[model samples]
Target: MKKFICIISAAVACIACESRTYEEISDNTPIAQVVTYNKDVKAIIDANCVSCHSPGPQALTNYSQVKGNINSIIDRISRANGDPQKMPQGGSLSPAQINIITKWKTDGLPEN
Candidate 1:
């Protein structure tokens, strides 16, 4: 019984010591998919990106206007993580959202 308790305790300790990586934590989780201006990306952008990137001759409102500038968006997101030109200005986007955007850009910015 003592040996069994020790083995169980060791197992618990090993499990407790195991740490999940950021990718592991963020991977396979259900997040908004934006394969080209879909609802998920739209919602994120609407709440975070549109305020600064919208269009109107002097503005660039809506997803359609921004969708054409996929490279710029990806660059902005890449630099935004630690820069002032970041989306939403002060708020932070989830890693999952960022990953989705990055993946979308990598996948050729499809309009699906």
Candidate 2:
């Protein structure tokens, strides 16, 4: 009975200690500098999204396209790795990378 109580207590402690999501973590992280499209977001998009989304119905080859699709971009990128609608298809972007893009938007979508 003592062992069972200990195990149940441990299980409850573990269950109560929930980890933060990337968005939550990012929200608490402070940005030391401004985030911009040319310097920050373009590289991430080029490396992750351009190949499939460019020269097609929903292109993201340039700033205008990217800025125009910012809402969808955020939604797709925010999806979990295995989610069918997640951007970058087979993989997920790091929290830092995602944070950079999110910061770019929060910074008013600066091109430079």
Candidate 3:
């Protein structure tokens, strides 16, 4: 009985210590898929950025604007959490969302 309890406790400890890597979990767009502005990046920007990054001179509301500012977009979004220069002001995007933007740029900024 004591050995059974010890084994169960050991199993629980191992489970608790199991680390979850980003690639281990699913993302909105799979890494294997080709990321595009319209398909993956647009949604991420719309949901996390449009509120503050739109309807202004520095708007990111359209594909053209986003593609034009890809460098800055990637820089700002890639900032560490709590960074004063981090984008979207108060919040941050998920790792998957960030990856999508990076991959989009790497993929030559596909519009469709």
* Candidate with best TM-score: 3
Q: Which ten residues in a row have the lowest lDDT in candidate 1?
A: 55-64
Better of 2 and 3 by lDDT: 2
For each candidate, how many residue pairs have backbone atoms clashing (under 3 Å)? 7, 0, 0
Model 2 ranges off by over 4 Å: 1-29
Query: For residues 1-112, what per-residue lDDT tens digits would candidate 1 score against the true structure?
Result: 9999999999999999988865577655644544565644667677777676655542436555656766666666666456987655676766777777776666566655
Per-residue CA lDDT of candidate 2, range 1-112, in tens?
9999999999999999999876676644657799999999999999999989879879999999999999999999889778999988988887778778888999999999
Candidate 3 residue runs with Cα over 4 Å from true position: 1-30
lDDT by residue for model 3 (1-112), tens: 9999999999999999988865467475658878888888998899888888878889999999999999999999889879999987887777778888999998899998
Clash count, candidate 3:
0
Name the weakest run of 10 consecutive residues (lDDT summed) in model 2.
22-31
Better of 1 and 3 by TM-score: 3
Cα TM-score of candidate 2: 0.73
Best by lDDT: 2
lDDT of each: 0.66, 0.89, 0.87
Q: Residue 10 lDDT in model 3?
A: 97
